[model samples]
Target: MASLIEDYALLSDLRTGALVSESGSVDWLCFPRFDSDAAFTALLGDSEHGRWLLAPEGAVDDCEPQHPARRSERRRAARAAGEEDPLQGEAEPDPAAEGRPVVVQRTYVDSTFVLRTLWKTPDGQALVTDFMPVGDRRASIVRRVEGLAGSVRMHQEISFRFGDGAVVPWVRRHEDQKSGDTSIVAVAGPDAVVLHGDRLPQGHDHRHIGDFIVSAGEAVDFELCWFPSHRHVPARIDAGASLQETVSYWKNWSKDIPQQESYHAVVKRSLLVLRALTHEATGGIVAAPTTSLPEDFCGERNWDYRFCWLRDAALTLEAMMTHGYEKEALNWRDWLLRAVAGDPDDLQIMYGVGGERRLPERNLDHLPGYEGSLPVRAGNGAVDQYQGDVVGEVLVALEKLRNMGGVEDHFSWPLQKKLLGYVEEHIDDKDHGIWEMRGDQKHFTHSRVMMWAAFDRGVRAVREHQLDGDAARWEELRDRLREEIMEHGYSEKEGTFTQTYDDAEVDASLLVIAQVGFIEYDDPKMLGTVARLERDLMDDAGLLLRYRTSSGKDGLSGAEHPFLACSFWLVEQYARSGRIDDARKLMDQLVGYSNGLGLLAEEYDTVDGRMAGNFPQAFSHLTLIRAADAINGHGQRAI
Candidate 1:
């Protein structure tokens, strides 16, 4: 079985990423592009589905103590004292951990995705450093094993399965003429990878396995590169130099962020995650690197998030802009111009990394999902959904870019006008809400508010930026929308805004009303909405759910855990509305939900106390940045 979602940390080369577990297994990886078919799909299935693992032969969880006499005694003492068990709510200890090499420690080399893990066996100790070279050199991963204390027995396994683990790749072993080092190549159709290492594994039934011993002062290097099956093998890279370059690249990129007073380390780490999720060649920001990680485990709530959602990309841009990352913001702006260029009417909610449309969602039935959550899927069906709030998110993010002194050219202004024109044409249409609900389309209140925000931005551009547009017409539409929302979207009986015009139920998206400048964060009506949200959305663990899945509004079976991004939205609301204490308290609790590496998933499963849904979620991290900014009073003003 795969490790818990929180146990995985991301390693990115800016083009694509790999998920390395605490056990030193690269279980999920998509090469060449963010939207490409995964080369390692063990995250959704088993090692047979494809994985690369390098660890001691008998590796075990470090937390499971080898000498259990003192551990049992301490546990008994704590239980007798009536103190809560430290392992309460945790999964039962895996019996399989016995007799395995113990991991002493694992952490990213500070400020970089370069991973370092220390392992200890009865005989010796060893250290492993894993990282992806920062530059996009056809996607590569370099892992180095160095003996630290004594001679340690190490095992390595590589199972190359392409086409999302459906293909059994052909492997060939050859000796390098120049250096006489062993090299292995795995080929499947057009995808091929060359593996270079001092201690290469032997191929067996489409799997590569090896066992070796490393003594103190000895080191070994393994580098894997993915390329075209028809092309010549890529040249070798010096692992040490590449590592230094990768470290320097990340440090230099992050050095310029404005000095943060609060959540300083976490803010920087979240920003790096955003940077990691973005495609280097194109400015498209992916929602997450992995697909088919369940939201409602063992259920059908799993959906692919590898594609770039307009709202997510826009929010990511805003987060970057807040910290003065204009170059990246402008790149996303250009990508938007290219993506939605042809027709204002043909805009999509999401797109492929290269701005390619026509994402067809399909399930890979061959592979069982994460923890047996079946129907592991690829692509996103929501791409075709008409999410009315998307352009508002874009407009809001772009406006932030403008406020940050981003020069708007003719193309940029004209494109905004076209988007506004499209909104004007479809202002009265009923469609999917921000959640991309699969149920019947309704006049979602959040969507309507975003419509109002769209016009408000147009008026702002014309008035504030001295840009060319119909300010008078936009102001009229903006006022009319505000009136419409108050009259129809809110329920006087419920004392709060409804999820849709037809229902009295509140939605978490309502929290963004003040964020888009539609209402004051502390207005009694808005506060009433917040109160309703607190009562309805707060789960057992004090985290916020997106909505009551029992309501059948989303047209999905099975319930989901609390949404991480929604909790952050509430934190932003708290910080902005003069509820600083509430904001700080909630913010600290929400941050606690993140893994040791400061990475968050799409949702938090309170029952299991584990992160659920897609790992390293862009929405979760971006909102974290926004919430932190609001807490520090660095959020200039909600766009």
Candidate 2:
């Protein structure tokens, strides 16, 4: 089984990424691009499907166990083992045997994304490090191995099962004339993979096997590149130079991030992970790199999030822009325009990385879901839902772009007008709201607030940026929205705004009403909503749940964990409202939820003390950046 979601770290080429466990197993990865078929699906299935592991070879023997249930047995075992190190063991075992130790430990080089894994053997140590060039457009993964101690034998395995490990490609080998080295190539359908390294393994059928001994100080490098299967052949490049370039690129990109005095290291690392999740060429940032990671064990609420949602991408861009990454913000704005172009009626709440539509949701019954969560789904069904807040998010991003002095092109102002016109026409229609609830639609208070924001920002664009738009009409609609929301959405008896006009339930998303400038942070109503959220929605650890699942509005069984982004929004609200001490307390607790690598997931189950949803979520990281910036006096900048 794979480790917990929080026990994994992220590595990417800025187009796609892989989730590597702390135990040095790359359990999930999409090749070539973010939306491409995954080559390693072990994160959602068994390891036999696909995975790349380089870790210490050991059996769980003796230790000062952390879990209370195992402590007594662990103590007894520790006394029996005396002083022996638990990790020392043999490398090879029966392939069909159970309880075998494979990959073991992983970490990144300080201030860089280069990941190193250590595998132990009875003889010595084997090390593998993986990294990618930060700003490069090409999709590349580089792996290097070294021997640190006594002579240790290592095994190399390669599998080319693509499309969630269902498509096995034809494999071939070619010898390089200049270097006298061989490289393996796998071609199937639209994808082709080329592997280059020293001492290339000999192949029989679709399998390859090799054994090499590495003494102290010995090093070897391996490089893999994916391309279109129709491409003639891949050219050779210097692996050493590629490694150096990748390191230099990441270091330079890391330097561009603004430094913070408090939680400096943690904040910088989260920022880098966020940058890695962004699509370099298209500027569409994925919500998370992998999908179908369940939010609750044995629950069927799993949905794919690899595609780009307008709201998530916009907020991600805002976070990056606020941290001095203006280029990413501009690129995302351009990508947004291209994605939402054409008939206003056809505008989707989410899109593929290249703005491709037709994202029909489907299930892969062949592969079991993470932790046995059934109905492993792909391609979000929420694409067709009417999310009223999407246009508001886009308008907010456009406003931020203009505020940052980004030049509005010929298509930008007209596109903004068209979107605003659509919002003007459909602002009253109650659809799915921001949560994409499959249940009945109601007048969600947060969605209404965002509608007001859309019109408000639209009017400001016309007035300040000198853009052409119906300024007077937008202003009137904005005021009307405010009036309607106050009339129906507010619950006087509860002293707070309700989730929707029909229900008096408090939602964590209500915290954003103040954060997004829909209302003053210190306003009595906003303060009341904040207090209600803290009392009703927050778990014991101070993390905020998405909503009261007991209300049965989400159309799913079994409650989900607290959403980290919502918690961060609360932190921002508290800080902006002059509750600095409360804000700092919550901030510390939220930041402490990060894994040892300083990466966060989509949600954290406070009661169970486990991470839920997808790993290295962009929303969580963006909110962390936003909250940190607010507490640091940077304030929320328009992006």
Candidate 3:
């Protein structure tokens, strides 16, 4: 079985990512690109579906000790003596760790994406360093295991499940013509992977399996490269050099993250996570790297997030720009121009990496969903939905980039004008809203607010930047939208803005009333909305759910966990509202929810005390940076 959602740490090369668990198994990975079909799909299914496990030769629990329970015992014993628990004041233990597992320690090497996992057993100790080297033309993963102490026995298994575990590849051994090294290859119709390693595993039961022992000072390297089946396998890359280069690349990139002294460490890490999600070449940032990691486990709410949402990518760019990363913003802006280049009506909420538009949603019935979340989905159906807020998000992000000294060219400015035109065309159209509600479309208040922001930004562009556009018309639309929202979107009885026009229910998205400059953070209406959200959206643990799932506004079965991004938004709201104590306390708790390696999933299952939804979510991390910036008073007035 796959590890718990929280147990997996992410490794990305800007093109694609791999999820490595505490047990030393790469349970999830997509080849070539972030949206590609998975070759290691075990995270949503059983090991038989697919996984690459490299660990000490024993049952996973042999070296694991239940430390949380033990810590509870320690506290109890300390209380018996009328003393405080000694470890209470220390930094929290690694979440992935349980005292000492066979894989005792897992951590990123400084700010880099390269993950170093330490394994110690009765026999000896070993270390595995896993990384997907950056700047490669094709996707590649290099894992190196080195003996740290005395000799240690290690097991290796690789099973290729193409087409989301529905298609198994034909495996064969071949000799590299140039290097003369024996390599194992797996090929399906269009996808192929060549496995090159110093200690190659032999074939067994359709899988390449092996057992090897390494003594102190010895090391072994394994590299997996994905390519088209008909083409020749890519040449081998120098594993040692690639490791050093990857490390250097991240360290250099991290050096200029624009210091945030308060949450400096977390801000830097969140920036790194954002960078990991961004496609290095195309600049399309995926929402997350995995699909069908359920919001409600064992339910039908699961959906694919591997594609790039304009909303997510734009917001991510805004966060990056907040910390002085204009280059990334420029790259994504270029990607946006290429992606939504045609008629404004042709725009989509999301797109595949490289700006491919067709992302047909489908179910992978062969592989059970994460924790049995049924109908494992691939591709996002929301891509076709009309989200009025999307163009606004794009404009806001670009405006921030402009404020950060980015100069907009003819292409970008013209594109913004066209998007505004599109917004005008769809002014009265009911949208799926920011959450992409699958129910009947409504004039979502959040969507209306964003429409206001879109026109507002367009007006600012022409007035402030001397850009070419109809400033008077944009101002007219902006004022008209503000009036409409104040008139209909707000509820006099509820004393706050409703989810949609004439609706009574409140949404956590209401917390962003101030975030997008619709109102002051401390506006009486916003404060009232915050109070209503506190009453209805807050779980006992104080985290915020997106909306009341019980209300069936989303038209989906099964309830979801509290969205981490929503709570982070609350933190921002509190900080701006002068509730410093509340903001700080909530931020601390939310950051604590990140797993051992400081990676957060989409949501937190308070009842289960585990992560729910996709892993290392870009939305969650981007919001973390935004909230931290807000607390530090460094964020732009308009988020």
TM-score of each prediction: 0.94, 0.90, 0.93
Candidate 1 structure quality by residue, lDDT tens digits, 1-639: 678889898999998999998888899988888889999998888889899999988673333442232233345457668887755565554433544577778888878999899988877889999999987465899999999887998999999889999998888886667776668988999999889988888887779999999999999999989999998777677999999999998999999988888898889999999999999889899999989888877789998999889999999998988888999999999999999999899999999999999899998999988877878989888888988888898998888888888889979999999999999999899998999899999899999999898898999999999999999999999899899999999899889998999588888999988888888888899999999999998987778898888999899999888889999999999888888898899999999988888899999877656788998999999999999999999334666
Model 2 clash tally, residue pairs: 3
Candidate 3 lDDT: 0.87
Model 1 lDDT at residue 357:
97
- Residue 269, model 3, lDDT: 91
lDDT per model vs. reference: 0.88, 0.78, 0.87
What is the per-residue lDDT of model 3 for residues 1-639, given as tens digits with 9 covering 90 to 100?
A: 667788888999999999988888888999888998898998888677888888877635412333342343355467669997666677665533443326677899999999999988776889999999987665888989999899988889888778877788999888978789988889999999999988889888867888899789999999999999999988778999999999999999989888766888888999999999999999899999999888876679888999899999999998888888899999999999999988778999999889999998888888877756789998888888999999988999899988888898879999999999999999999999999899999999999999999999999999899999999999999999999999999998989999999989988888777898999988899999999999988999999999998998799987899999999999998888889889999999999998888899999988557888888899999999989988898333645
Q: After superposition, how far is residue 91 of candidate 1 from its true place, in Å?
A: 10
Q: What 10-residue stretch in candidate 1 is worst by lDDT?
A: 61-70
Candidate 1 segments whose C-alpha is farther than 4 A from its true place: 60-99, 634-636
All predictions: root-mean-square deviation over Cα? 4.6, 5.9, 5.4
Per-residue lDDT of 64 in model 3: 30
Off by over 4 Å in 2: 56-105, 118-122, 133-138, 201-209, 634-639
Candidate 2 displacement at residue 506 in angstroms: 1.5
- Show pairs that collide, candidate 1: 58-100, 58-101, 59-101
TM-score: which candidate is best? 1
